[model samples]
Target: MALDVGMFEGHRVNRAAAERRCATLTTRRSVKKAHQAAWLVNAVRCVDLTTLAGDDTEGRVKRLCAKARKPLASHIEAGLGLSAGELTVGAVCVYPTMVPHAVKALEGSNIPVASVATGFPAGLMPLHLRLEEIRWAVAQGAAEIDIVINRELALTRNWQGLHDEIAAMREACGDAHMKAILATGELETLNNVYSASMVAMQAGADFIKTSTGKESVNATLPVSLTMLRALRDYGMATGHRIGFKPAGGMKQAKEALAWQILMKEELGRDWLNPDLFRFGASSMLGDIERQLEHYVTGRYADSSRHALA
Candidate 1:
């Protein structure tokens, strides 16, 4: 699909309405006991188990890969009647240089390695260099590439410029899937968020991500609702579905349930899978693991028991 300003231009989002809708998504819909456990497990499958810290090391990435491989402990899996190695996160996300470590660590498993490229977190580098970064990550065996869009372009409403740059990055990704980070917090208005999401999808983004996990505000429900509206509109007109990922500041199993509920209600069960949704989280898994342990034994385990993730 080519860039089409007609799709999102002049689009307006009412913040109050969006906030009200997000509010009901949690209070009105509730999953308890077994149903809650099931949704949490689904959330585990959609997690992009990530380690993007500046102090990231090969050892750390491998450990994260190990967690991704066996997200649920054997005791918990047995209690749930799940087989060994039956559960795994959607992908292992790391810095570009750490992709090889994750790729090797996750070998012989179905999980894919994801790398944050295109000068991630800031994306302030020159365009040519950013394109090269994508190529380099793909060569390093990253099956998925997360690239941040230039906030300046979106802020100034330079749709053509934004589209061209993302298209170039997509070309550089080659065979790898691309998740375009909209950095919604910096985009100011919900209108800007919708327009940017539309532009990213039009430029061939396989997923429209909410943030890079670095912004002061990241992955708020109101902003995510706006992006999903754009995603739904795009799907309606073009019949091509795109994924959604909410990254940063999510650290509870209940938060996982909330987002999954949002996806199921707004986009149906189709978006409930890894192909259409992802949680770019690192610590959130710890809480989920703890909750599952509690569900199995009727006692909450110490946070340290599930702290590895």
Candidate 2:
């Protein structure tokens, strides 16, 4: 797929309307009691149980995999009317070096190991090195690759270059799904956000992600709405459904419900699952667990009960 420059032609986002919609999304929806707990469990299912840090270790990655396997205690899922094996995170996301650790730990459970590649967060490295990083991670058993787009291309208005780079990354992924991180915080404009989204999807990204979890600001509702609108337009134009992920700054179970409600409203209920949406977080799981505990026992579960920090 090539860049269709006209895809964004005449595209104009009404800043006020988008903001109003986001406000309504924030205020109108409320998931309570059993529904809130169910949505929290679904949030657990959609989480990418992540650990991306300067000092991530095999021990840390394996523990993350363990968390993904049984995001809640056996009794919690049983209380929620789910089988012990039914509750799990969407995937385990980690740095490429720890893919094997994640893969080994998550073996036989069918949980995909997602590795962040292509000079993640900054993406300032040379193209060959970045492409090689994707190949290396895939060869290491990464079932999915979360790639950072070169912001310079989008910033410089080099849509073709941006499309080409992402297309190459998508190719290198082979059988693995590719999540193109637009880093909305860095794109600087919702127009750029929507246009870059069109370009990423045009270039074959299986999922268009909002951030890399390393930005000063990340995954705000307005930016997400802009991206989801692009997804809606792209899907309607091509008859292909792409996934959306709101990464970073989403640390509450209530926040999870808000994103889910946005997805349902904008893209319909189909995208509420792990296949189409994911929360890229390591700490949010703890809050989601606490909320679930509150639902199950009528009291907040101490943070220490959940292994994640």
Candidate 3:
């Protein structure tokens, strides 16, 4: 009698062969679980100084820092808290002079202030003035600084100039978290965005942000996907983990979740934490709240009250 080779050759097989394949599958699953465990351990061990230092501050500064670190839901609850256990959201991003307003809005909540600097929308200012703007922002309690990269230099292939400007701005940021905006719309190409993303990371950007929100063209999925990939590659090559923020055009809960999904898919679960991801928007928080409310209440919110300004 001839052996039935057909059944044994593929996924379908005799009992004995299937048993052997089951053993292989079990071993592979065990190995994968072990690898994931190791990755999780390393991630837990990695310390984010920004987050750690945030815990030590005091007064309004401490509140803002904590609020900045809180998830979007927590921020909204603070505003609507009818009880004593709830605290307001603490961190906000605003124009240079608007730092005080953000600070006041977040008062008693202990949120830190963030300000956009260096002729933010255009970034067409002298180096000294930009540095001064950063200093002034920090002096006014801006714990986070978002600076726009000069698009002309980036577009003209002036990598070194762009790098130096970012480095200078980083220094001027002092201890504040420095988010370098690529202004993706102006870059106008995936290749440019990728190259600029690498330049920003290599030049000392604590976070490589997608856009300034002032431009007509704002952050998009393709541009964000490209930037995240560049950061992941850069991290692998240099062993320095970089953060990503897709700012502008993020207006709805679905949009925020889409960016979150993109980050998780592109950068892995290790980057899913707040330390590695942020959504830069003046209007997203309210949408996130409304969605959360709808999830719980099964109805859209009567009014959307969350606004950065």
Candidate 4:
């Protein structure tokens, strides 16, 4: 995780090969029956159920927390060999201002509250204020902070600046684990994505994430594969395990399994856990719940059955 400024210089991605591989990863073999049910349960465990809307409210945050707590409904939980207090999501993510509501709702539970900080989705604020926001969220009981990297730094080829910025954000995060959102859609090229990923990890990001879910093009398979390569490289170079989160536009149970398979293939089985991997998603749980219902009961349930509220 050294500040290898030129680390991304010579890396070449054969788009065809990468695309083919990603396609294969998702389509080669679908997990089914009890195994599919298990994978769905794992998907539930790896989700960072998020709400980053402008209209977010305390009541919305409470419902989100409640969903994170049980994820699967009571009867569904029992049918899947799980019980109350079991099968919760990895964490619940919300805006910095909503951290307190989420924390209060999730109090006494092991579920961690992750706050999006540093101006979030767009890190354009003064660096000082962004740092203060991180402190504010942590003070509100946020155990994890997902900070967006200034895309302009990568857009303008200021690798050093991007690295330092993430480092500062990581420092501001203090004890809360920091997830560096690269916003890959705006990076425009796999090369830039790789460079940004390297710089973020070099600066001590606990996880290098793919998007903000606000981008027009968020978290595509090829972009995700590129980032996974960077994660694997960072781990090998530093002997420290770093996490990877593919956020945005992944809403189906099948889609979650695809990403999980990609992780398993590229980073090994250890990356399948909540500690090393997460899907930053808001609507994916509903689909997974639907699929699980089909698996366990042989009846396809409506997505409405697992509504967030």
Candidate 5:
């Protein structure tokens, strides 16, 4: 049902006036106080992970394992270029094998490397093996590690096992930032995602990612929102700020922008930094290049091949 604008004109006029009056009431002192208050709140809410459920938490270990075998050279290169000059939405999350390509593509660029570990997409490997994988990626120049939690352990209510693995991976990352992939698509439940997010954060995950981009069901708005909310709550309880990344199936510039907006609105301005937010995209770079070309040249290119490296 569509409503007539004329019917609400009087109310709209009053609302506009009220807004103007309120705007005028925002004194410099009040504004400063508000800013300080927000800063204090942000400082208090940031935190780490807490616990987990079991290994079969979502029954997606096999699927993630398979996608890991696929080649992702082009995607990694493109993602690095997309964030080369202009302000970027986030870090490039890639497979361990693709870390070198990403490093080469983003060399000297501000965009950092985020490589997956712990048998990425699948957390079915042993804890020692996962740690070794993380160490190797870091040695290969990965600026960050996006490791998967043992969903099987989470599903079985083995919170301790999951926590220990995450802690070890975090340590393996050395000085590089660690992002924990929840693989929400496999979990298929907000409750499960929440539990996993809390666990990863408590175990020292610098960021809580939504998916690995390898599942049929990758990042979803609902799942991302839920994870963000959990991170926000966790931050409030602890004092360590955690980042959020929604990877997979994000191919359009608008989709990336939407996630950025969501993160800013839900988590506040402090979370909008690149270190705290990122888009784990595989194909959105071309779209961004096209847009930049159109803005600069007055015409869009059919392909991104001509874009500078």
Candidate 6:
């Protein structure tokens, strides 16, 4: 697949309509009691439990990996009739320099170590350096590389430049899966989001991410809807299924339910798995674990009780 301006050049997203649809999405659909617990469990499996901070340390990454390996508390898993080692997060995401620690920590757990590379959050570094960073992370045993796109390229409508850059990064990723962060908040419009998404997928992005978790605005329902539309369109045209990740600013169990509902409705149940969708959040897991505990015990646990994630 190659870049095709015709696919998204003239595309327009109706913000109000998207907002309206999202507004009613939660209110109209209700998964109560057991069904709600099931959805929350599924969300846990698809979460990319992340830790990306300026002061990140190897100990912190290992702790996060330990959580990923055993996400649900023993009592909660037993209450739900889930076996030991049955449930785990999709991956443990961390800074590139911490990939080795994560890899060692998650060994034999079947959980992939995902590292954010390519000048993550800003992506302002030189192109060559960015590609090399991706390569280095893969060599460090990262199974997944989350690379941020240059927002300047998207803002200026340089789709060709954007596609070439992402394509090169994808090449540098070798066999590791690449999630291209669109940084949609800085792109200024849903039109740019759609176009950038198309270009990223055309360039062989395994997934199109909504943000770097560093933008002022990140992972809104309207923006996710726009990206999902592009993903669907790309799949229809190229017969390739691409994944989606919405990172940042999502910190509640309800938000996880909302996004999962959106995914099921828009892309069907097929997209509800870890391979097709992921929530990139660190604190959100605490909320989800609390909710699961409440479901099992009919009482909410303190947030600190599930703070390991």
In the range 1-309, model 3's lDDT, one tens digit per residue, is 111222112221133532353334323422223343232222212211121122323344334334344433443344333234233232466677766655665555544566788888789999899999999989987888889999998888677788888888888888999989899999866667877878887778899988887779898776776677678777877788988877776666556545555666667887766567666753455555565555444566654443322
How accurate locally is residue 49 in candidate 5, as Cα lDDT from 0 to 100?
9
Model 2 poorest ten-residue lDDT run: 26-35
Which regions of candidate 3 deviate over 4 angstroms?
A: 1-90, 104-110, 304-309
lDDT of 5 by residue, 1-309 (tens): 121222112221233433343333223223223343232222112211010113321123222222122111233324434332233323445567666766665556555666778886778887889889999999988888888888887776566677787888888899999988888888755666777777788888898988777788888777777787778877777777898877778766445555555666678887755567766654454454454444444565675453211
lDDT of 1 by residue, 26-122 (tens): 8886689999999999999999999989999989988899999999889999998899999999999999999999999999999999999999999
Between prediction 1 and prediction 4, which has the larger TM-score?
1
TM-score of each: 0.99, 0.98, 0.71, 0.98, 0.67, 0.99
Give me the displacement of residue 192 in model 3, in angstroms: 0.9
Q: For residues 225-268, could you state the per-residue lDDT of candidate 6 as single tens digits?
A: 99999999999988989999999999999999999999999999
For 1-309, candidate 2 gives per-residue lDDT tens digits of: 778989996788888888888888757756689878877877888899898998998888878888888888876787788887888899999999999999999999989999999999899999999999999999999999999999999988899999999999999999999999999999887889999999999999999999998999999889999999999999999999999999997887788988988898889988998899999987889888888877788888778897772
Give the TM-score (vs. native) of candidate 6.
0.99
lDDT of each: 0.93, 0.90, 0.63, 0.90, 0.60, 0.93
Please give the lDDT score for candidate 1: 0.93
lDDT of 3: 0.63
Model 5 regions more than 4 Å off: 1-93, 98-110, 296-298, 304-309
lDDT of 2 at 28: 73
Candidate 4 per-residue C-alpha lDDT over 7-121 given as tens digits, one digit per residue, 9 for 90 to 100 = 6778877778888888788567868799988988998999999999999999999999999988887778878888788788999999989999999999999999999999988
> Candidate 3 at 55: error in angstroms?
33
Error at 270, model 4, angstroms: 0.5
Model 4 segments beyond 4 Å from truth?
none
Question: Candidate 1 vs candidate 4: which has greater lDDT?
Answer: 1
- Regarding lDDT, does 4 or 5 come out ahead? 4
